[model samples]
Target: MEVVVVTLAYTLTGRDTEIVSQLRTVSDTLQTAPGLTHLRSYRGRQKGGAYALFLCTWDSENSWRKAQEQYSPHKLLQEAHKRQELLVIDPLQWVMHYVWGYTRPLAAPTLAAIHLMSAPPEQEVLLQNGWRRTLQHHVQEPALAYAFLAHSTTPTTDEAHEGPVTVLFCFFSWSSQMERDLFYSEKQIRTMHAFSEQGSSVQILALEPL
Candidate 1:
């Protein structure tokens, strides 16, 4: 079966406590939705709670779309929307192929990082290879939980935004936050830094399972 990760990055006009409560309601409602196997809710530490990422996994892209329509008019969702305005910065759907490690029977991770990256068209092949190799090395660690690497087949690009570029999504989960931070500060991440373009960067959003 194909695994798809749908990331909804949004900002709320209301307070964090209020927004999180609404998210919990959404999560509770999704329990009955078809095809949705996992739901992980996260707040972006990089922006001081101004942003949040909702990572959800489905059996396939088609099933996910069907669930969207089915759940669009749910009363729980309508109630959440009424409490606060959700300004979605990016609604990205990634069809991820397994590079290394096992990610099944999904559990709440202690900490997870969501990365959204853009690479020049010319470097697409190299970019994918670099990410795969780096991920493979990390998978060897017993503390590493799971890692997924995917690129957007249909990325949003316009004249105002940069022209059509390869969008890469990397999600990693660690046993603890300290290990996660160390992995980035040490040599492993530096190797990736040297392998890709200078402009290629990822936002390290600290995560929690809803």
Candidate 2:
């Protein structure tokens, strides 16, 4: 399957400019990497400092794996140095990183929402079942131009719940905000309960492509 790398950085203290610049500088090479289909960066702000979201999509798992082989020791060392610089800039910042299944690609998407939450390890199957069922049901919605259901792999964390964390990001697009809210409103009454019941807490992050 194709892979969509999702990375969110929050609580960045006061060094948002430098951090974003560094991130862009380091990420520039991915544009020419094999299998790289799309690369985008977004910036937002909340209470702490600033927020940055990076969405990188590859053609397939094998493509991403093969691309990793090109990372040399010198390149790794340079990335490490950049990380150290980030640490020095914002010691209290925290980041959430995950690679999710990229089943659907964006097509001039105008709006998006990232659903973040953690669920019990035992509910992985149920959660996955919910995604399949929901996507199947919503495929015909006229207002929903696109839909993507993605989950984390290998990464297991207990940050928001008692068990493993599953970050489900649903990137959507509609002709208008009214249409967008209407679809979600209808969905909340239907599928949201079906899937959200498996997780403890949920946060929906609104996004725009930068």
Write one digit per residue (lDDT tens) for candidate 2, span 16-36. 567666656546665667887
The sequence of per-residue lDDT tens digits that candidate 1 reaches over residues 90-206 is 343444443434562444457887666666655655777787887776656634566677666555553323666666777788777776777787686777866654546444556
Model 1's TM-score against the true structure: 0.77
- lDDT of each model, Cα atoms only? 0.61, 0.55
Cα error of candidate 1 at position 162, Å: 3.9
Top candidate on lDDT is 1
Those runs of model 2 whose alpha carbons end farther than 4 Å from true positions after fitting are 11-27, 47-49, 69-107, 163-166, 187-198
* Top candidate (TM-score): 1
Worst 10 residues of 2 by lDDT: 88-97
Candidate 2 residue pairs in backbone clash: none
By summed lDDT, the worst window of 10 consecutive residues in model 1 runs over: 70-79
Q: After superposition, how far is residue 208 of candidate 2 from its true place, in Å?
A: 1.0
